[model samples]
Target: MLPLFHNLLLQLDSASGILRITLNRPSKLNALNAATIEEIRQAMQYALDAQAVRGILLTGSGDKAFVAGADIAELAELNEIVGRRMAEKGQEVFCLIEESSKPVIAAVNGFALGGGCELAMACHLRVASENARFGQPEANLGLIPGYGGTQRLAQLIGKGKALELLMTTDQVKADEALRLGLVNHVVPAAELLPFCEQLLGKILSKAPLAIGMIIDCVNAAYDQERHGYQTEANLFGRCCGSADFREGTQAFLEKRPAAFTGE
Candidate 1:
């Protein structure tokens, strides 16, 4: 494990089965630089393999900008090949996050635009502060979202709304985001952490394997023509057949809240 550092803005912590990854550049509003991206990817992979971690939380430092955007300086000099590589790498990392076994939640405190919004959207679900604003502003920068933004945005909101957001480069407020189903919950900045913890707690209280299956099913639900639904049904049935499911059912019948072992 790496020791925490001041300049090294990415903060990683675990408590009560929740491992948090905070983009630590408050001075710069937690912008995703290449270094930051590498660190984030590393932290996520660590949490993915760490048995002690069952749920993950991702947020930004300070009260503004979960991630303002990607570090533009790093991309300013990139050629076509380099740009393509960066996009591919970002997509891979973002996909890994979306498909992580441990459910990851994004706590958006402020302006989550461009890559910032993309990062939040990559999480299993988003919980935003009342002041948080979200957008995919790459179009305005003469660049498209390099992460999974283009695909995932449409999956989260509808295609029409996603296109509107992308084309207009307009930031959507928390209420609008909630209405669009972009965020699960919206609370004041003072309560952002607690709100995220509450949602994470709800997820942690369930069977771990079941949570994983549920995430898989929901992500699949976006593709109506694909075998996603069938796959989800099959996985759901398999979970129902697990020992954890049996114990959970028995516990329910015995008038007790089930303690799922996630077997």
Candidate 2:
């Protein structure tokens, strides 16, 4: 069972083992406020802990946005010390999503600007609606992306282009975002969630442990303290010790579908 949230709507599809977490403040274009962020963190933890949840699909309640940005009203009140803490808090929650063992895909239904774009980038994959617009426009506020956007944006696209977007505050349309390698797929607005579900359905069918280890290895590639190759080797050895690995090999030899228990 999923916990109730003040700012989110959690629906666990038991048949598909996918948790759908919707940011529920449609009146605010699903903007992230401190309450919303904290609730998201809680919801993410629930998804992470639930054995029935194989993956997560994150989106907003309304058609206008997945998350337009952080709540500017709340942002305006931040002092220097509070601003730093606020950034750290947001980053901490976002990193939880980034480093999850279970796959999380952002279904970008519309504008994903500022912190919204950061949240999308933190996801394992992003599927944007044709109407979706992505940008890091914090510079307009005399600020910068505090939720790992500066780093992840550069990593997702390129440092040069990232710098251009950050400086110019240009919003990349869905098609342009795809070309920039920011979003994995650009489908019609109506098909955004369905497409993400279809994509996750395919991934969830794979060996769960291996899927998680792959996430770890890929993330390790960007971790300065971790050797990606060594992480892969270690995880490979770990996978070799699992029942799923044994079943996978045996099923491959027998020409049958393998049933992975995530063991």
Candidate maximizing lDDT = 2
Writing each residue's lDDT as its tens digit, candidate 2 over 97-118 gives 9999999999999999998999
lDDT minimum window of 10 residues, candidate 2: 1-10
Candidate 2 segments whose C-alpha is farther than 4 A from its true place: none
Residue 217 accuracy (lDDT) in model 2: 97
Candidate 1 local Cα displacement, residue 99, angstroms: 0.6
Candidate 1 Cα errors over 4 Å, as ranges: 1-15, 222-226
The alpha-carbon lDDT assigned to residue 193 of candidate 1 equals: 84
What TM-score should be assigned to candidate 1? Answer: 0.92
TM-score of each: 0.92, 0.99
Candidate 2 accuracy as lDDT: 0.94
Error of 1 at 234 (Å): 2.0
